[model samples]
Target: MAKLRTTFVCSNCGYSSPKWSGQCPGCREWNTMNEEVEEKTKVSAVSSVKSKTVFSSVSSVTEISTGDELRYNTGIGELDRVLGGGLVKGSVVLLSGDPGIGKSTLLMQACGTFSRDKTVLYVSGEESAKQLKLRAERLNVNSDKLFVMTETDVESICEYIKVNKPEVVMIDSIQTMNNAEIQSSPGSVTQVRECTNLLLRTGKSLDIPVIIVGHVNKDGAIAGPKVMEHIVDAVLYFEGERNYAYRILRAVKNRYGSTNEIGVFEMGDGGLSEVENPSQALLSERNVNVSGNCISCVMEGSRPILAEVQSLVCTSGYGNSRRMSTGFDFNRLSLILAVLEKRFGYRFSGMDTYLNIVGGLKLDEPAADLPVALALVSGFTDKPVPDDVVAIGEIGLSGEVRSVSRISARISEAARLGFTKCIVPRSCLKQIKTKADIEVIGVRNLHETIANVF
Candidate 1:
């Protein structure tokens, strides 16, 4: 009989240790070390038969031929755009998000489109067939070519895929998958890593695209070992607020697509419907001539999107002034407030300030700084910015507005949305080659911006 071995592994970074520790030495995360058991197999006598060796010739980059037929459209334009064009052959995509964030619904909706001309196999470890059927019905996803299997054993599932050979395969989740040969539990570091490896290998060998759903931990990161993300070809994150109807799908890593691309969707009773014009959908409820509101354009991949920045400044009753932000970085807000107080002499020290980006869309671009500053000033002065005006520039600590890339695209998008005037960096004026219909005002400093907008 073979003896069992015990080891402690870091759940966050997959670092192994002989003894358990309160803090993971690899990731330096506390309480992430978990004990895992492994069974050691006894060595047997080697066979006398000779093994066959196979050799393959390597081709140069120019010699490799890639055709358009290798990609399959998921019937969702927004999803296809995020995927670079379409789902490529032999690629494994891992989609993760918070609970009730529409991760499963997105995949199920894509399955409906994939089953139109190809066979799809959906293997679920968490939900039963009845539950999936109910969801499919609610989403109006009915097709003869789409098949669902409720099983937790990954080994058996891979074997079935190899024999049946489905055109597309989807694992409802990778965490619930368990291998009988593994001594650890299903969602443990070892099991999730090994199961993902098995699925990746199966997809690559059969030239089939596999989409796997992943669960998020308490910190909103994908649960299980980080190596699982490294094993997959692409990693996508579905982001949105539970109370909000809009959801954003972003690619963190992709072998065949750009990581900067994003897909927008709106959750309804029928399921997730793609938002064709995200800028329009986001600004549909804009209240014109409202104080504390300013519009800014942001670039998501090659696409330009307009988002509203809103701020509220009021007297603070507490000892410490409170600063809060939603869908905008809190640290960035603090820095912006500091710049305002030190550079522009706007007093935010004794005030409670709150900032928000409409439509639950996070503003990570520095170009949004101008709008944020304008919105803060508008809220503080209780003055409304012109409804036809849009701001696009990066605000520096020295009170200067810095140049931003793709300034023309940003201005063009704002103009298309019926904005009459656009405030841009003075340095980027030369970058605008063609004349747009809207009026462009270039400002070199924050004082110039306030003089024009306010």
Candidate 2:
């Protein structure tokens, strides 16, 4: 019998320390350190000699080989677009989202695509084989080459991967998988790190693409070490309200593709269907000729989308005024209010103001700035901005309209949505041309823009 070795590890950042501390210096998380004990096993002289030879033979540094472009197209347009054209062989992708956000459904379809042309393995620790089959049957997509396995042990999963040598392998969730070498639960810090490391090694060594689904924490981020995201090739985030049918797959980080790309998906009985023309869905809830509502053009990566910006302004009571916002940024709303007061001479400080973007999509693009500002002003003055008028441009502190990214795309989206007029930066005037259906209006400042519109 040998002595037991133990160490304290921080669950937040995977910080390891010899002794337990009240505050983790590594991650600054309070009281997150947990003690993990490992049993020591004595190795014979012959075993130590064999271990040195094995360790020396395992190469740590190797050249990264790029995957073929043809294999990157997975038949799913939105997914492929987000993945920077397609799946790269030997790449590890981590897709994380809140529970019940169709993480499983999306991966099922990805597996189904490869199983038709090549061998694919769909490994799940959360669901049974029968359950996965039921989902596949309901979706009317069941492939013979798509093998389903329910296991959480890392060693056995590695053995399965070695035996099958499939073209692609997907783990339903990396959170639930654990390595036998770690003395912790399936989703603990130790297990997650080790499981991810092993999978990454396997993917690189065997040249098989691995996509792992991850669970999100309460703060709406992946529930694991930050290293988990860095260790993988790409980090995909699945977002959208469960009540709403539309779901978005956004790539926050990618090694093989651009991070700005997003994949739009609509959930239905048949599973998730890709929205080819996503702009149409963003403006589907708008009502024509409505007061306090304006069509706003926003840039999604390089693409443009038209969304409805609604604002409600009313006199306040008691002592304080209220400011509330939905989908759009709250800080930007505050700046817009200041512009309305200083530039438009409208005293909105004493009023209750609420700004709303019709759909649940979150946007930070500067193109929505002018529309949001105008929507608030339109609500305050009780003036209905013309139904055909669309706003696009960024607003500055001096009430000057700033240039936005991809103005041409924004103007085109507004016109495609049947908006006759667009208020954009004067610099964009050169790029915008006269169209029969839509009229593009260029403005340089806030006063000139408001006076012309009013």
What residue pairs clash in candidate 2, if any at all?
72-86
Candidate 2 Cα misplacement greater than 4 A, ranges:
1-70, 219-222, 225-227, 433-437
User: What tens digits encode model 2's per-residue C-alpha lDDT throughout 194-304?
Assistant: 788788877777888899998875331223536488789999999998888999999999998899988899999989999877778877766777678877887777778
Query: Per-residue lDDT tens digits of candidate 1, residues 1-454?
Result: 7688899877778888999998889989888788888665722111111122122334677987775588999999989988889999999999888878998899999999999999999999889999999999999999999999999999899999999999999998888999887888888887888788888878987899999998876441224526578888888889998888999999999999899999999999999999989999999999999899999998998989999999999999999999999988898899989999998899999999999999999999999999999999999999999999899989888989999999988888988889999999999999997477999999999999999998
Top-lDDT structure, candidate number: 1
Top candidate on TM-score is 1
Weakest lDDT window of 10 consecutive positions for candidate 1: 44-53
What Cα-based lDDT does every candidate model obtain? Answer: 0.88, 0.81
Error of 1 at 442 (Å): 0.2
